[model samples]
Target: MATTSDNQLRNPPLSDQARDRLRAAILEGELKPGDKINIERVAETFGISRTPIREALKALETEGLVQIQANRGAIVEPQVWQEIHHRYRMRSLLEGYAAELSCGKRDKKLIAALQDNWAQVKKAGQAKTVSQNSARSIAELNRSFHRMIWVGSGSMTLVRFLEALDLPQSFNDAFYKEQNARQVVCEHHGAIVDAFIEGDTAKASTLMERHVLDSVDLLASQADDHVSNLCC
Candidate 1:
């Protein structure tokens, strides 16, 4: 898995790495809706060239994370409640199916690994390491947990399609930021583990669906409150 480095994230070019960071920031609400991203300023801040920044912005344009105006450069787009709902629907359908297939088939080794990741999430959250490393560790654990379940389903095509679905517009990342959200998500992981252990495919699928949808609702509600404060 070739990935952009954290150094790249901190000192980015207008490349995919920069695009990912900017997108993460927007989704995380560090850069809010209607905020303008000055390409020159961002370039200077990240110590990168404008070329990669422009390129990254273009990539984000396709993902609906940022909108580029003829004269306005890049601006964060306002995400409506409905669209967020729709995104979760897609996630639920895809990941739920994966969970269903995963039941009774998940490699024990993989489950243990996921368990380890959850422990890390707990440790990082307790340590109050809210910096990028802590955040990334948490996010990566979450991703690994889901991906392992999905991959265990043995549906390569489904896994590929779900991968294409990619990260939602910063929604889950936002949920991870909330103090209570961490505990909720970890407990949700526990629920998922229980279902898997029982070899109850239906239960696993239902839990996955509810877990994901609950997250959507939680994040959307928080986003509403945050946006309200910004408006004030």
Candidate 2:
């Protein structure tokens, strides 16, 4: 149904940058979950036209970060607590399996790559707080870490399935911005990496499951703190 001109207009590399930027806005809470994104405003902000913005938003939609409408603009996907639980539940299963498979590969080069990305994740956690600007870099490192595991597993099928399970960082960004919470996350990353390095498949799987669930627990705790503050 589409014309060749329409296909030619799409720029994937540029659109990918836009997608990452928009996703960061959602993750940093600059664009709250369930909020509508203005295409024109985003175009102005990024100096790109609506076509690329649409492309990027559409891409993010596939990743569960935003939802697009025909009549309206894109909406940052709403994340209910139950939805969060479900997402993490799926992540625990798929990522745990990915980690388990990756550990079995026993590839030293791949292990080093994973370690390098994990170190970046650890370093990024040092910021006293996460902001719209800072979240992009951290997200990049986090993405790399997860992608390495998927690739290391050497299962294209597993990698494809795991692609959709990216954490809605918007939910946990504030929690991770806190010093104590950030430290705990860093420790978890370290332990997981250690498992991979030692080729401990079982430990990797268990740690991955715990790490995914821990995020949900942290978000719930943050929500409770907000409620208590209101009550007080």
Per-model TM against the reference: 0.76, 0.62
Cα lDDT tens digits for candidate 2, 102-175: 89988899888878877887887787777755666665666677788888888898888777666545544455
Q: Which ranges in model 2 have alpha carbons more than 4 Å from their true place?
A: 1-79, 168-176, 223-232
Clashing pairs in 1: 14-52, 14-53
TM-score: model 2 vs. ground truth: 0.62
Q: Which tens-of-lDDT digit does each residue in 7-114 have in candidate 1?
A: 986765549777876765665556677778877777776678989888988888787767789877777776634554777788898899999888868567766776
Whole-model Cα lDDT of every candidate shown, in order: 0.74, 0.73
lDDT of 1: 0.74
